[model samples]
Target: MPALTKILIANRGEIACRIQRTAQALGYRTVAVFSDADADALHVQMADQSVRIGPAAVQQSYLNIPAIIEAARRTGVDAIHPGYGFLSENADFARACQDAGITFIGPSADAIELMGSKRLSKLAMIDAGVPCIQGYQGAEQDDATLSREAQRIGYPLMIKASAGGGGRGMRLVHEPGDLLEQIRTARSEALNGFGSDELILEQALIEPRHVEVQLFGDQHGNLIYLGERDCSIQRRHQKVVEEAPCPVMTESLRQAMGEAALKAGRAVNYVGVGTVEFLLDARGQFYFLEMNTRLQVEHPVTELITGLDLVAWQLNIAEGQVLPLRQDQVQLNGHAMEVRLYAEDPTQVFLPQTGRIDTWQPALGVRIDHGLLEGTTVSPFYDPMLGKLIAHGATREEARRKLLRAVQDTVLLGVRSNQRLLAGLLQHPSFISGQFSTAFISQHFAEHPCLHPHVPCAEELAIAAALFYQARAQAYRQPLAGWRNNASVPLHFNLGLDEQQWSVALDAVPGGAYRIQVADRSLALQVIDCDGRWATLEIDGVRQRHAYHLHAGQLSLFTRPGSLVIEDRTQALVSGQASVSCGTLKAPMDGAIVDVLVTQGSKVSKGQLLVVLEAMKMEHPLKAGIDGVLKRLQVRVGDQVKNRQVLLEVE
Candidate 1:
């Protein structure tokens, strides 16, 4: 077969750019398909050729099989690389590519179909002599049979969507009473996420480590496992951090798990890159979870350890080539850890944050796979993940330390992210000592929160933000008002941060210096250096250089703790209307109202669920923060709302 000369990436954001980079290096022309929302995306700009797929909605664009296949045909590409998510594991898309005489850079349609469904995959594993958790995979879809199966499986069971992964259609029920409701939710989410409502029941393993083996196969029927990744660090069933060479993995355990992974591949005559996930319990017994039939999101850690380009291998395999490396030929190297930087607020229950990234500065001495630019607008239509940071070192401790520094040095302004949270996790004693389970975040961080909270730099940021704004204002004025020979007056400003407001005063000192006072905390600051988007200041005799960005009346000050955004309320304060507070609850972000749990005029207690907002493919339920009567319900199910739009009023 001829080699894949031109390829079309039927995905967007970082994955698209990632595929383009590898394809270009291998002497292949690349084409990128993008939605309306991603017209100015980084991936689109990096590709050799581009095509407009459809609207911002995923169904009309990335997941639109017909459109993607047509784009490949139009570009005259030989193969289509569905870079994970979207249509990557969709058997129909792969089959479509094959029917169109275009290569799909992944496993065969038969392999994907067999492994895509958890129910069928479990049965397949059982037939192949793979140890699987005791659960129900029968075809009975009735609630009575499922409930009976749940009873037989006992309490503390898991309900999962048969059609997909990514924690979308999965839920845990610890009690018999909650099983039915959870099953309903899981089915709804499953059908919406994967177009299938088929459910599967599994015995929930208590605190088992989530380990997966990365394997590759070719048409020659040779399969080899590169290594394993410890994906035990998760939150809300989504993996936040992953590492290669699991801390608890011994030589024997590795060999056993690796063999099982190879057995899984051989069972399906698997080809191309795939991941076989397993749950390793405290006693070292591993049980099959499922198989992912495409390149995984955490593939970088494996790549770093094996020093092999999995994407290059995928291309070669698609060209009907033999396996590049044998089992013995693969050598494990040093340690590597990856942290996903999401556009979210860890403090706010991980609610997705969206806005333009005014300042984008990634740290040095690490590998950053991202699609962010200075003016990148993070829309609510896509995933909240901004990028990923991978750090490699000779030792696990060294890798952890380097990753913590990398997270600290990184500066992403204008949107809230989990940078500080990731830093905190790396410094936690449990993480540092390598003694953690899948429940690490829940047991230590989620309920308790902030294992090592960054010291509060709010006061410093407030003062610096004021000074930066004042400097910008004066720089564009005649004679530079603040630089006058006899500067005697002070500039008064009001800044708002969430519920707290700061009354700040800045007095221009002699020689272009300033004395800033924010609610009695005075700081003697000098502008050591500054540019359009950054500033270096000497505050109270301590020198610190930082990046700052001002856009749409909001100022972002990049500090060691993280980016601090302060809203300029000076005008509102002067107008005497800023101090007013309303009892209306607004939509936290732009999303579709999925469910209205309460009716108008219904009384609600504190923490009572009110409405569910779906954005970035996740559901966030809005609850009442105060006990009151829900006097008005402003939204209904399926209603699309904008950020800060009033969803309800409580009184």
Candidate 2:
């Protein structure tokens, strides 16, 4: 254990940048490992030095242990910090670093291996009096065996991966008939995501609040719990929003959870920063989930609440320094919340999206940790998380309010994202009151998705749309052809950006108003004010200001950048077929073909899996729409595909 001079970060994205800032603050030189896609990434430029790990695909780059180790070796780094994902919990990587006489900057290989398996960790917890919800974690994992265990647990249960940590390796079963399939899906996802199908069972902890306590340990046998974080605001088990000092927690419950977390950490002799997750029910009872041996994605919430630099602690602990503070000295400050700004389409069930953040600015008084800043590309090969927008306030309500404002002001225009939805969720009554659960997204949700409650043709979006097309048409005419010394010609254009398909259309008219076609009722739009990129107008004769942006050569009227793509009709492709043909399979959008699940001529059933596409660090399973023999596999593993390009054919 010594004062480290150089530390190499073994991951990319904002987390790597976050780790670097802390390490640099402590006077340590930092090196960054980046893939080709991240060559121009902010982290690469921020680090003292950077090395090319491999290609953009995570498997060959960030997740490749040898490449990361080599990056460390080449940089002459004293320690390698696996900043969360790629190999954060990898025991072999830890051992290799140890063998090479370099510190892993995380827990020992034994600690990682012990907690790597849920069954083993649960056993250790149970022995140490850590109460876990009743579920099976034995060796028997067949379909029937898992079914019996699920039934024994209850009608509502959860299937968890033994080695899974993220929301990836888990499934929820609400009915007995759906248990096996859920288990299979969970196991399959676990295998695909973590390279392990080994799973366990647990009580789903119905409608319980998701809470986790942060634990810090050092080699000197000292451990402290840094209170808790309420990551209940989640989608697809992935956290969309998180906050500190859960409003739902009673003082008594907090102490109890904190003590339980310490016991779990001490039992495994955990080192560095880790989080012990728990499911807190309405009645305030809590149950053990698992321990994350690395920094959590939502660690910013903890840092804000405790006002401590966790990355510095990781470095110090790895260098064999005893913790400077004791558990009794820990204090929780004002409320803080973190919203994950992802390149995703919130209007389309939170799908991962990739594009540029053309206008990147968070509201004032908010701490923005952006990975893909303005002019940065949101690549399809990595996690869609562009940055974390965190806000701290005197109270949770104030924090939530500030976070909503931050989201509203962000203006991410390149690809779709849940910016508007995030704003809506932050202001949601249930969310504000802190009444949330895992089923929050799919349950009691809106049947219709609209950026704003009302879409006025005479609004700012309408004006921007008309102006953009008018500008394009003007450019086509002449540099001074449309130069109106007489009068400004009333521009006319049509817009067909019907997001839900059941919605209406618009035929643009002069002076920036439009004739609307929603259902059988056609309305008139009157333009009131035009502000270049924004407009103010009347829908049915009511005026309201709205957000608008010009991106991808089209005028998008305040739409989520993640899901919906607004195409200028003048540039849209016209297909001869009324419907896409039977045999052809096209990609939903532009993304890398991460995995070719089915080969050419592979027989498949309707909805059977074909390829696993990874875009924006999220995995998408492309299923067969019709029962047929596959033909003309257009993509190979690691090939990048685009929107509407035929990925395969079923004859």
337-367 per-residue lDDT for model 2 (tens digits): 9988777665445668776656554557788
lDDT value for model 1:
0.85
The candidate scoring highest on lDDT is: 1
Clashing pairs in 1: none
Candidate 1 lDDT over 471-585, as tens digits, reads 5556677666555454576776777766557677878755657777776577787887777577777788888788888666677777764787777777763421111133467
Q: Give TM per candidate.
A: 0.88, 0.80
- The predictions' CA RMSDs to the true structure, in order, are 7.5, 8.6
| 584: Cα error in model 1, Å | 6.1
lDDT of 2 at 610: 83
The per-model lDDT (C-alpha) reads 0.85, 0.77
Task: For residue 158, give model 2's deviation from the true position in Å.
Answer: 1.8
Off by over 4 Å in 1: 447-459, 465-469, 472-480, 483-489, 574-651
**Among these predicted structures, which one has the highest TM-score?**
1
